[model samples]
Target: MGWCSCINLFPPSCQLSELKSTMYERQKKLFDSCQRASKVVAYRLKTPPYKLDALEPYMSQRTLELHWGGHHRQYLEYLNRALGKNDILYGCTIDELVKVTYNNGSPLPEFNNAAQ
Candidate 1:
């Protein structure tokens, strides 16, 4: 028999199209589960308890502003972007988000953002 004819020799379950469909269904289920688990929530940056200049001589105002305002805020922005409104991790606490995105050491794309 020709190469094309050999495809029919295999059972329907073993066919390439069937395999792809099965994989697609599994992915769709996962996506749906994530969607169902998510809740809408807003994340905000917390202000430091003390004034930025409180630690003067020990830590400069400019340094604190750069680190807290610039870097920390940027990290939060990136995290919010990564965990878009409908994301599975959306509305999760920072600690929980970090742990989940860590993915048992495999680490998802949002792990860094969550950890930061």
Candidate 2:
């Protein structure tokens, strides 16, 4: 006899149907959770308070632009890409992400991007 046929409390058919129903409910819940987490948030890069050449005497316009627009912008892009909508870290604040990714002394792969 099959495993389901050995059950004495409920009919074999009823037990099998109940098991299938329970499995279906679990699958549905998982599917819904994934759908909710699929909405990725896009972070925008904030511009400097002053013009690119604001600190002309101390810092050159080209240098500031390269650092701010190039390097900083690139870091933000990497961070956003690393934290996708489906990622558990996606909705966390920068501070939270940094701490979580820090993993005590050993850092995770996304630690650098999150720290930046």
Candidate 3:
């Protein structure tokens, strides 16, 4: 039974039941935090903020296509692949993964590019 549902069983001035309800709320918060900490967070690439035509005059449309659509897309693909091989590194926040795999100053070879 959830904490809120238990409220329906008690009268307004019931002190003992109210105390139990408060304890239930505290336990629920701790339980929820533990559950959330175990969840896997997936990483993804951000789409280009501006359209390909937005950077005209100086940069051409082809440059934008190859840079954003090609190179950046491939980097994200590599990151996903690197994450798949390491269970400890899987689902880590980007900053956490980078620091964890950095190996003091030098990085592990396979993940060095993907991490940075």
- Superposed model 2: Cα runs more than 4 Å off: 1-40
List lDDT for all candidates, in order: 0.71, 0.69, 0.62
* Per-residue lDDT of model 3, residues 1-116, tens digit only: 65544346656666887876765565344334442344455556677788887889888889988887788777777777776775555655565556545656656543464563
How does each model score on TM-score?
0.64, 0.60, 0.57
Residues 37-56 of candidate 2 have per-residue lDDT tens digits of: 33436656788899998898
Worst 10 residues of 3 by lDDT: 27-36
Q: What is candidate 3's local distance difference test score?
A: 0.62
- Top model number, lDDT: 1
Q: After superposition, how far is residue 26 of candidate 3 from its true place, in Å?
A: 33
lDDT of each residue in 39-105, candidate 1, tens digit only: 5475567999999999999999999999989998888888888778435566676766676667567
Clashes of 1: 0
- Best model per TM-score: 1
For residue 34, model 3's alpha carbon misses the true position, in angstroms, by 14
Cα RMSD, each candidate: 7.6, 12.8, 17.2
Q: Candidate 3's error at 115, in angstroms?
A: 4.4
Score candidate 2 by TM-score against the native: 0.60
